[model samples]
Target chain A: MSADRLIKLELSKLNVHLPERRPSLREALSSARPQVVARDGSTHAFKREELEFLAGLLPEADRDKLQLPILIALEPKLGRGTARISGEAEVKVVSQVLEKEASAGELLIYRPEVAILRKKLPTTTQYLFLW
Target chain B: MAALAVSPTRMELLKLRQRVGLAQRGHDLLKEKMDALVIEFFEVLRRIQEARMKALEQLSVAHRALSMCFAIVGTLETKQASKETRRELQVEISTRHIMGIAVPAVEVREVERNALVRGYGLHMTSSVLDEASREFERALKLLIELAELEGSAFALARELEKTKRRVNALEYILIPRLKEALKFIMMRLDEMERENFSRLKRIKAMLEERG
Candidate 1:
């Protein structure tokens, strides 16, 4: 029982690095120092160049729709080496970066594609583990 | 693996099943963390390779320029000029978290300065000396960026190792032991139930014989 409790504790601590509130692209671009606070009270900063690149991908009206630190959801049930990218603005920007045809609001990408997306947009992208 | 010490009862079997479920969940989540860390590690490694090459090339170029200055402007005079120049350079260092690991984020302040701002007297230092200074300044900037990339790679690699260890422990040790204990309790309960059934049957036969 004690061992089981410890496992639960470890699971809880897994996502402490995630931000309390994710800022939109517009809000982050307008700020002098663009960053979001994590649940653990640490700050995660966005690079200015990455913000500009993301902004350039979308039009003026879509800036607010795109959120900072676009989450790539990783679920074990999805099978190994697969991840999902959700949100319309996020999918649009990611597809443009990867040179893939933009799908709907969600995109299921394989391992190689994930690597390309990460290499292209390191600061603006984050991995989110879903049980 | 040794099965856990517990009385073989239905209630204990229920608790063991729950424990096995929790262990499996933990193992899966931790394996996912390990996979994510591997990706992060390789990403950092890729950047570090590019940064290292750039920094090394710039450093060699700076060294060549310095050699030229020493040959043309006289070694003693070049040394004197270097001594007179202002060498105070500052870098802003901070932490950026990737997952839960804190990797270094370094921002170098303006390192390249013009001839006048270099603080060495204009007449004493020749154009060759200025060229050397400029090249060295560029090399310094590249080296700082390289350092930041290398630091992140190391941090990521360390975290990857740790997560891998935890995943292995769950997969190889904890889960197997729990399952073994669950199997033991289940088999014991079945045996006890059969014995009770036969004992009640014998008692019923004896009562019928007496009647």
Candidate 2:
């Protein structure tokens, strides 16, 4: 195959680990079983400890507003080593965990921060690739 | 006859060199990636071995406990208890990406410790069976986590092997062939230019002599 075609194929596979749709945090918390199917037709589960930690971070009312499997955006344009944590509750929880000051809406994190977040919430956090 | 030749030969040589450089860079980076993946894979494998051993041992212990309960509480009653017990345990699962590999998230539900929820009938209920089930449930959770980790480790290992092979091919074969071809072309171009220069000079000398 041509170099261009090979690179395109590699880039296409970058986000095959992500879920088609995410369940809301409330649904994950309430359901006895919570799971999401990946693009590659595999099932992925969330940890209860991470869910509880997220629940503790927000008010009871915000549980429904927040979503499970908080997306950690990995965009090549964000540079080779940076990722973003978006959404109000996600930002708030992540900033608190990393002991960084939380802004209102989104949090831009470096590679180290992303690694730390993944370590802390392995099952509840997923990496999403953005063009 | 006097028209200048563009000589795209030089341009092709430059482009070929650049490609060779890119291929070399890619090979080096991919080798580094494979090394990192191997390190990660072995670490997970070590953890999995430990987890599997512990989980299986715990399961055996639980089975022994249940056997004792059956002897003490009557086999019929014990079997009846297991049937009546609420086995509605659910796990919350999701996927996380590690270096482009998707690994399963296994969050096993905490088995209820409540005596009522334990669901063993009072007639021949032995605390031994409850304890056994609890232990087994805990082991099951740990085993599931280990399974997920092991599965991911295996997948990553396979991908690492494939990447390593590609890197090796580029470094040891494809890039080298391209460079060799480029060198051959360059040598031929230079020899042709030298011959042309000598021929032109000889023709000029002959023409001058004849005039």
Candidate 3:
């Protein structure tokens, strides 16, 4: 029972770093200090440079559609070293950054590509773990 | 292997299954965290490599400029100018989370100051001194960046190690043990059911023989 309790605690702590509410790109760009508070009550600020870079990649109309701290979902079911980028705007921005083709609303990127993407946009992207 | 001590009952079996499930889930999720941390660690390292190179190069350049200043403007004068120059440079530091681990985010605002702001009087200050001051300022800025990157790399590496240990514990120890206990309980339950079946059959045969 204690082991079960420990596992439950571990599971709960896993996603505490994730933001409570992710701001849209439009909201973040318009604000002077673009930041989001995590579930753990810590503030994470987005670098204006990275935000501007992401802004340039999308059309003005799609700016609102894009979300800050874009989730690169890593699900075990998707296989190791593979991550999924969902949402039309997110997939588009990520694919454009990696110079890969985005099919449908979801994009599957490999480890190398994820590295490159994270490198290019460190503050604007976050890793999301999915069971 | 030594498994957990639990009664070989259906309820205990179900609880064991749940524990195994939780353990497996924890292992997989922690493994994912570990992998992400590795990616983060390498990224920080790659950034550190670039930052270190740039910082070192700037530092050498700054040193060369200082030596030139020392030669042209006289070492004693340059040292006096350095002492007179303002040294109160503030770096804004805050915490940022990368997957539950806090790493420092440092912001150096306006490290490069001009000749007038360098606060040394114009009478004694020469172009050489100003040049040296600017180069050193640049070097300081780069060094600050390098420090931030290095700090992030260390924090990420530590988190990665911790996560890796948890993943291994689950993979190599906890999950396996839970699974072993699971298997033991299922086998025992099956054996008990078989024994009960045989006992019932014998009772029926004996009753029929008496009748």
Query: DockQ: which candidate is best?
Result: 1
C-alpha local distance difference test of each model: 0.89, 0.73, 0.88
TM-score (C-alpha, index-matched) for candidate 2: 0.61
Residue B178, candidate 1: alpha-carbon lDDT = 90
Q: What is the DockQ of each candidate?
A: 0.74, 0.09, 0.73
Off by over 4 Å in 2: A7-131, B1-8
Give the runs in model 3 whose Cα sits over 4 Å from its true position. B68-81, B120-127
How well does chain B match by TM-score in each candidate?
0.93, 0.84, 0.91
Query: Which candidate's lDDT is highest?
Result: 1
Please identify which of the two predictions, 1 or 3, would achieve the higher DockQ against the true structure: 1
- Per residue, candidate 1 scores C-alpha lDDT tens digits across A25-115 of 9999999999988888988889999999999999999999999789988877898778899999999999898888889999888888888
Model 3 interface DockQ:
0.73
Cα displacement (angstroms), candidate 2, residue B50, comes to 3.3
Q: List the residue pairs that clash in candidate 3.
A: none
Classified by CAPRI criteria, candidate 1 counts as medium
Summing lDDT over every window of 10 consecutive residues in candidate 2 chain B, give the lowest-scoring window. Answer: B1-10
- Report the error of model 2 at residue A9, Å: 5.4
Error of 2 at B173 (Å): 3.7
True contacts kept of each: 0.73, 0.09, 0.76
Candidate RMSDs in Å, in order, are 2.2, 8.3, 2.3
Ranking by DockQ: 1, 3, 2
Backbone Cα, N, C clashes tallied per candidate: 0, 7, 0
**What tens-digit string does per-residue lDDT give for candidate 1 at B62-153?**
99999999999989999999999987888999988999789999999888998989999878757889999999999999999989988998
